[model samples]
Target: MSFKVAIIGRPNVGKSTLFNRLAGRKLALVDDTPGVTRDRRSHAAKLYDLHFEVIDTAGFEDAAPSTLQGRMRAQTEIAIQEADLIFFMVDAKAGLLPDDTTFAGIVRKSGKPVVLIANKAEARGAQGGMLEAWELGLGEPVPFSAEHGVGLPDLRDAVVEALGADRVFGEEDEDDGEIAASDVLIGEDIADPDAEEVPAYDENKPMRIAVVGRPNAGKSTMINALIGEERLLTGPEAGITRDSISVDWQWRGRPMKLFDTAGMRRKSRVQEKLERMSVQDGLHAVRFAEIVIIVLDATIPFEKQDLQIADLIIREGRAPVIAFNKWDLIDHPQAVLAELREKTERLLPQVRGIQAVPVSAETGRGLDKLMEAVVRTHRVWNSRVSTGKLNRWLETILAHHPPPAVAGRRLKIKYLTQAKTRPPGFVVSCSRPDAVPQSYVRYLTNSLREAFDMPGVPIRMALRTSDNPFAGRAKKRT
Candidate 1:
């Protein structure tokens, strides 16, 4: 098992900045505002030769448990409990405070080994504060600058001495040449350029599905239901989740990674810079995921923002499945479901046959149907057709409704072939690629979807003029 290290500190003390440095990438959201990180996020990290898992947690506060800040502190406490080692960070420039001393006592009571990191030591006035950090009684403070790469080697030595180099490097020499899930690049569903056809997805790899919706739409609650744990902080508060948290689990023996993202609201309403960053982070998760589950409040389903979110999913070429959440709250289930289905078709014609499952995350009603729909949608998203079959279908489509005349010259579609899958894309060779009306393209797209039974996933078709070998030579002679 990998060793776990958690960074705990008061808000805006550069805990997230240190985490991003250790992870070798910016995994956590960092800002000047206090309490920006409300969830404890963990990622695989390496420090020179030492490899371990590092967790970045919410800043500790002294609010009541009923309040949001208190809940955030509760999460931090949980992180302290789970960590095999802790990096109790203090702002070197701001000097030691009473909260640092208090939290140091809490970490001391936990009985875990700790490394004191006096961050921002590069600042001109940080020397006195770094000296004061010793009063916390954790250990000797390592003057560190998380932003400027100062004292990293000393910090690494401290970690090695505390955890033991053997503990840090255990099992690393066992060479299997296997790639970890973290090492796999994002957008793994895209086609391999060297392969003749879009290859089948490796079942061993975890499927990444991002759950997104407006604020208080039960995304985190639904994820908790699916994973059977309250791993995320949840309550009556809107936007309790501020980061895109990814949880790994197995469903009926299939490995899956579920990303619980911060709720996204309208652009006009998102005036705060922190909320804007949260929304952008959620959008990034959608791009990285192969499938997106858009949760909607069943009571007031298909709001304007909900439609915009769905359209965004389709535009991203991700397999989309609608979860009509809070189903148990509905007074008339049958009628509401019927009306919602009608609205889905009318509002989302791009994904003509999108699957919408009514589920109550609170009660676990219809969870199985939701997963079933997800699996079906994923299969369709990766669907592929042979060139011959696509050309034959194209012929039938053209016979039914040929391309419209452009300037009294008839357009001819020469051939059709699928370029890739994972939200299937096709290339059409035609006489006049630019003259193909978008309406006609829509007709062919709909027809293709109906014929191939590909519903809910975006289908991309590119028009290209067929190559003429002698056209340039003839023009030169003339």
Candidate 2:
């Protein structure tokens, strides 16, 4: 129930200072150099019991027409457009510059309310620079010194006024300016390493699932059946869904967010701006998603683009469940299901052992099974396997099928350990990492998948040469 606010201004205008002040932490590095921050940084914060998310962005400064800065400016504009509120800061001590006037015009066009802050107010008086700020046409400025911790209350009051009274943030406590509510999550996710306690995420927690696929693959139809409401705008047009929308629902009473993506077409074919934006927006949904359910048109399943998209999910370390949509279209042959399974196995070998369910988004066929696939794959994504058990499995794998002969020498894989697990990435120390063929790497990966019962999960194995397997060996032969 928290809202998001962004601190934006021209470079070196104490925007980062204001961010660090409101955040109550030194998350953003303060430096005299302008444009130090190149990317958008988001953090949770509290301003007088009004708990919310805040974004510290790269300060905008005019560049040589169209350069990297210009592209980054586009990203900044997008962030400003997305945020609920903005803190348009200007250095009162330095006075308004020409670029500031230019930026003021840009902010005015955003159509979102802005809180203009005359920063560096403690340097002298707000008289001179505050007068200069009047020409920007936003409104009267809230002069404050971020470094000196001044004028924060006026900033807080401005936010409450903009958000209104029927609010999630009731009021600030009379004592320490913290929210009096039990539900609010306080402080940024970042904290001091020595005394900080992080909020742990529950993997058992119901995650947002997205069903992304090509046109008429039953995205709208599937959601309609899942929620028992024809909520999505579905039509016969190839790319009718120009927006990726989310719906809240539950699986066995557990909360979930489901995103239905538009039909992705070839880059050469996407003519309209809406289509291009829809594709980009759909990709964003994929990145935010915990488990991405890739709905496929079963008639032409595992097309090059579908495979590429599925690979992209695995590459991003996201758990994916392939849903063969329009399953009802295919008539049942004597071994049609078996044939489909084989096709999936061969075409998308990268996501080996992953579930590929057959379902019709139109008729809600196999949705129960689809949810089961989603839950299972999600569990596998957040899964962590013990190093000892993994090493033992690796031992068995190496014993059964030793590495291929290279230069008339059989390479011995000395040890294997699960270094990290998001998709269960493993590091195997061997005689020669480069000499190990892709087929052999595939062999070990396939073996690990079967041994761990890790169906619907991507397995990653990397080969590296160990300097010494017997580093501390002594003469103990008996």
Candidate 3:
């Protein structure tokens, strides 16, 4: 197990900047806005030879116990308790505020090894403030500049000395490869340029999955149930999660990275700057995930927003598995299940025969089936077809219902081949590609889905005009 370090401070003190700097990537969203980070986010961080898990938490704030800010403070306290060491950060440029002194005392009470970081130390004006930070009495303040990458060596040495070099290094000898901030793996990344074809899915690599849905859709609850732990913050509130928190876990012996994203609302309804950032972070999670599980409220499954979220997932070319959450609450399970199935197929015909797994996040009912569906849908999404087989299938398809004539010329499809997978995409060479109607393309798409056993995953098709050798020949001159 690696050492855990939590960075806690008042809002806008450059804690996130320090987190990104230590992680060697911008994993957390950084802006001038205060309170952008509401939930705690943890990432594998490396500072030269020291390797440990670093948690970036929301700023410490004083608020009523029933308020959101108070709940955020509660979450921070949990991190402090779990962490082996805490980096008490302060804004050197802004000087020490009353809140900083209050939080500093709180950290001192925790009795955890504390490293005082005076951020914005690059500014000459911050020099006086850094000197003032020593009065807090935690320890000597390390004047560090998170943005300018200054004084990081001193900070690292301080951490190493505090945690002890033996404890920091542990038994690990080399640096674990860097994990990207985005954590998104696109088709291009999986495809090998030197190889003749796309490689098979590496089971050794953990599958990146994100749970997304509208506000209060039980997304976080579902993930917590799946992981068998209360790793995420959940409540009656609609938008408790403000950051895309990724947790690594094993599902039936298979490695998986599950991301619990903030509840997404319609674009027009999003107003506050913090909420807007939260939504963007959720979108980033979708892009980064190989499979997106859109959790829906069983009582009201097929709302417009649910369909919109599904459409967004399909548009991103990620395999989607619809999990109907809160199934235990539905009094008429059979009727609602039937209606949900029909609505899913009718409304989202783009991904015909999409998997709709009914699972109760509260009771953990049907979770096994949901994971099975996820694995199956992901396989289909990454499936590849041989060129010979595709052309043979295309021949049968064209023979049954040939392309209609356009401009007194019959459209002829010469060949077809699978271009990529992970949302299978295909390209077809035809005589009159431009004239091929979209309805006809839809026919081909539906036929392909039916023939190839590709259900619940998006399929892309591109029409390209085949080369014509005789047209360019000088037959008229003769």
- Local distance difference test, each candidate: 0.87, 0.74, 0.87
Off by over 4 Å in 2: 1-203, 333-335, 467-478
Q: Under the 3 Å rule for N, CA and C atoms, how many clashes does model 2 have? A: 1
- Candidate 2 similarity to native, TM-score: 0.58
The lDDT-based order of candidates, best leading, equals 1, 3, 2
Per-model TM-score on C-alpha atoms? 0.94, 0.58, 0.90
Candidate 2 local Cα displacement, residue 280, angstroms = 1.9
What digit string (tens of lDDT, one per residue) describes model 1 on residues 1-478? Answer: 3589999999999999999998877778889998899889987777787777789999999899999889889889989989989999999999999999988899999999999999999998999999999899988999999998788899889998888877876775423222254343322343443343545745555688999999999999999999998788888989998899988888878988899999999889999898998999999889878889999999888889998999898888889999999999999999988999998999999999999999999999999899889888988887777777777788888888899999999999998877777788888889989899999999989999999999988999889997788776744554
- Give the distance in Å from residue 114's predicted Cα in candidate 2 to where it truly belongs: 19
Model 1: pairs clashing at backbone N, Cα or C within 3 Å: none
lDDT of candidate 2 vs native? Answer: 0.74
Q: Give the runs in model 3 whose Cα sits over 4 Å from its true position.
A: 62-67, 122-125, 169-185, 188-205, 469-478
* Count of clashes, each model: 0, 1, 0
Q: Tell me the tens digit of each residue's lDDT in model 3 across 1-478.
A: 3699999999999989989998877778888998878778887787877878899999999998678788789889999999999999999999999999999999999999999999999887999999999989988999999998899899999998788888887875344533543445455322422233545765566688999999999988888899997777787888888788988899878889899998988889999887898889888889978899999888877788888999999989999999999999989899988988998889999999889999999999999999999998988888877777788899899999999998898998998888777778888899878899999999999999999899999998889986666876776765
Q: Which regions in candidate 1 have their CA more than 4 angstroms from the true location?
A: 173-204, 474-478
Tell me each candidate's RMSD, in Å, in order.
2.7, 11.8, 3.1
